[model samples]
Target: MKRLYHWPLDPAGRLVRLALGERGEAFETLESPPWSPHPDISRLAHGAVAPAIVDLKTEPRMFACGTRAICEHLAETGDGTALLPESAADRAEARRLWAWVEAACEEVTDTLLTERVMQWVRRDRQPDSARLRRGAHALRGRLTFMNGMVEINGYLAGRQVSLADLAAAAHLSAYDYFGDVEWDAVPDLKEWYARLKSRPSFRPLLADRLKAVRPVAHYADLDF
Candidate 1:
């Protein structure tokens, strides 16, 4: 049996889940919040952060962290999903696109999420309207670049689906839950998302609910 210690609402954790779905891998999911940061958190050097996995076959007791590392491990041992392309040129392109989304998407999405989403999850850190507004404004600039890519090609990385698509979807889906996405701005993006959200694996993520915040109806609509 394999176990994944994860936070249900974490975008980074969702990255790993998407990879698992891509590989058609099955593993137990455990809700592992930082109840006590003293021993379990990375700052404490105990277990890994959320979405950490333990493979009972080899090292059931030990755990692994880091999104790419975990997904790469699954791809190697499981169904060998063509996530990172083998061709040098393709791999380089894929890596480049993945990095671009990582640099901007998470920060931008987190800016909105931390303000509207995570703030509700944790009441201690008060939301800052000024910073959140700034992040939201700056994030729109990335939309221009993303719109261009979507317009030129069907997918975020290239013509076909790849980790880049999953990565970007994971970030944006969090916002979609809050009705924050301006779908009209990027029809290409909207079309691509329509297809992405249509997938079976995506359904569970879309259906995911946070007790503190209920997602918008469109968030679960595959057609939307």
Candidate 2:
């Protein structure tokens, strides 16, 4: 069986879970908190971290350390709806958007999402008002850009679902878990999210729960 080491709220980890689910691959998860590294992570490699995967099914145990490595690996090996588009140009566009989502969400995750996790889950300190505000401000900008893309193309890169959609959904879903997303502000993006949220691959993500930090009421609501 394959084993996935991941943090429940990490967008990268969630993205991998969604990809696995999309491929109908069954794997067990071992929690690797972002604040506390899992022992097995270092065992996999010197600086390996959560969102890593180890395939014990392989003779020598195939392993990957990051989203790019793992998702691309899965896309190559899995037999199902391609995670990437077929055309060369389409593939390039999808890859570009996929990278962009991660880059663009980095600020939001580091500030807003990180502060929320620290305050609610760890309870180590009070939430940082400045960081939260910064993250929210950055997130709004990203949402507006994404809204325009989906409004014009029906998806991030094109009409068909691709890794770009998954990447965007992963980050957005994490923010939504904490009720950070202002859905009303971007109606088109909200509609697009509703469609992705209703996918079968999204079921496991909807079920995710952080014991100390519960998701928002609408986190799991497909219609929301």
lDDT of each: 0.73, 0.93
The model with the greatest TM-score is: 2
**Considering summed lDDT, which 10 consecutive residues are worst modelled in model 1?**
36-45
* Model 2 alpha-carbon miss at residue 8, Å: 0.6
Candidate 2, residue 201: lDDT: 91
For candidate 2, give the lDDT of residue 129.
99
Residue 144 error, candidate 2, Å: 0.2
Alpha carbon lDDT at 159, candidate 1: 79
Query: In lDDT terms, which candidate is top?
Result: 2
lDDT of 1 by residue, 17-91 (tens): 777777776777767654432234463235456667777677326456867777667655667357676677876
For candidate 2, the TM-score is 0.98
Error of 1 at 210 (Å): 1.0
Per-residue lDDT tens digits for candidate 2, residues 95-212, read 9999999999999999999999989999999999999999999999999999999999999999999999999999999999999999999999999999999999999899998889
RMSD of 2: 0.8
